[model samples]
Target: MIEIRRSDERGHANHGWLDSYHSFSFADYYDPEHMHFGPLRVINEDRIAGGQGFGTHGHRDMEIVTYVLDGALAHRDSMGNGSTIRHGDVQRMSAGTGVMHSEFNASEHEPVHLLQIWVLPQRAGDQPGYEEKRFDDADKRGRLRIVASPDGRDGSVTIHSDASIYAALIDGAEQAALPLQAGRRAYVHVARGALTVNGEALAAGDAAMIVDAAAVTLEQGRDAEVLVFDLGALNG
Candidate 1:
């Protein structure tokens, strides 16, 4: 079965310099029915105005991943990791034990757009860590590239979670597919443009939760960039 979450149905918040849309319950946007899926916790599409950003904050036992779609995001953390993440960059930060970090738009005149994702870790009290990689358009064009995984296989960033994240860039008639394992589920998130996932149309900010799906397909895209997550069953 496939369940669709329309872009307009998400929770929204605007704070002068920051505009954000939450795919699940976040901050002040609480939805009991849309809390989370499996081990997937948060998906926040954020746009930060020039010279603005999130102040230093703390997190624990969360596998945090950030994907920049436009502009750049400057990041600094308590673990002494500092970097500028731009388009095509995937960053993973393990907030095990505990950690404090801050993120800011690296431009003074241009706003930065990005998706911040959080997944529950497979184990608690692990050491804090960070990793980042650039997945060029050529690597994702007409295909899904594994960008994050439990063991960092295929050069993906390690997340210490029973999940793998795939990134894709599709245009026109381009297509791609990922075979799902038994008992696993899938989550497709459209970052920009439009895409048809297994015959269901998804626009920017839209998402689909797929259960008992043997395979997930992407086709008939219109300049689309999407992220697909293969996740293990939720723990009770």
Candidate 2:
């Protein structure tokens, strides 16, 4: 089964300092039927106001991944890690035991736009860690590039989960496909611009939840940047 979730259907919240859209139930946005997909818990598309950002917050037992789209995000964590992540940068933080972290727009005049992703780890209470990597736009222009995986394979960031996340940037005549093994599932998220996923049109912030499928295909894109998650079944 393949299901499409439109951008307009997502839950939205707007504060003076931040505007966000939640793909699943998060904080005050609760939807019983849209709680989660397998171990994928949260996908929050956020735009932070200039000079304002998330204050130090605590998290535990979750694998968090941050993907920036516009501007730069300054990150500081309890693990003594500090950096500025810009476009095409992927940052992964394992809040295994517990961790406190904060993110702000590095620029004083421009807002930062990004996606905050959460995936459940295979087991709980492991050691906390951090990893970040940059993928050139050329690498993902016409094909899927492995950005995060279970073992950090192919230079991807390591996440303690039975899942693999791939990213792609596509334009006219550029296409890509990811084969899926039986019983596995896939989720395609269009981060920005418009694209065609498995022959279906998708706009920015749209997503496709696919199950019992052989593969996920991308084609006929118009300046599109997308992320595809190859997920293991729940509790597998």
- What residue pairs are clashing in model 2? none
For every candidate in turn, the CA RMSD to the true structure comes to 0.7, 0.9
Question: Relative to the true structure, how large is the alpha-carbon lDDT of every model?
Answer: 0.96, 0.95
Candidate 2: residue 227 Cα off by (Å) = 0.3
Cα lDDT tens digits, model 2, 127-233, are 99999999989979999999999999999999999889999999999999999999899999999989999889999999999999899999999999999999997
Q: Give stretches of model 1 more than 4 Å off.
A: none
At residue 3, candidate 1 shows an lDDT of 96
Q: List the residue pairs that clash in candidate 1.
A: none
Residue-level lDDT of model 1, residues 183-215, one tens digit each, is 999999999999899999999999999998899
- Model 1: number of clashes? 0
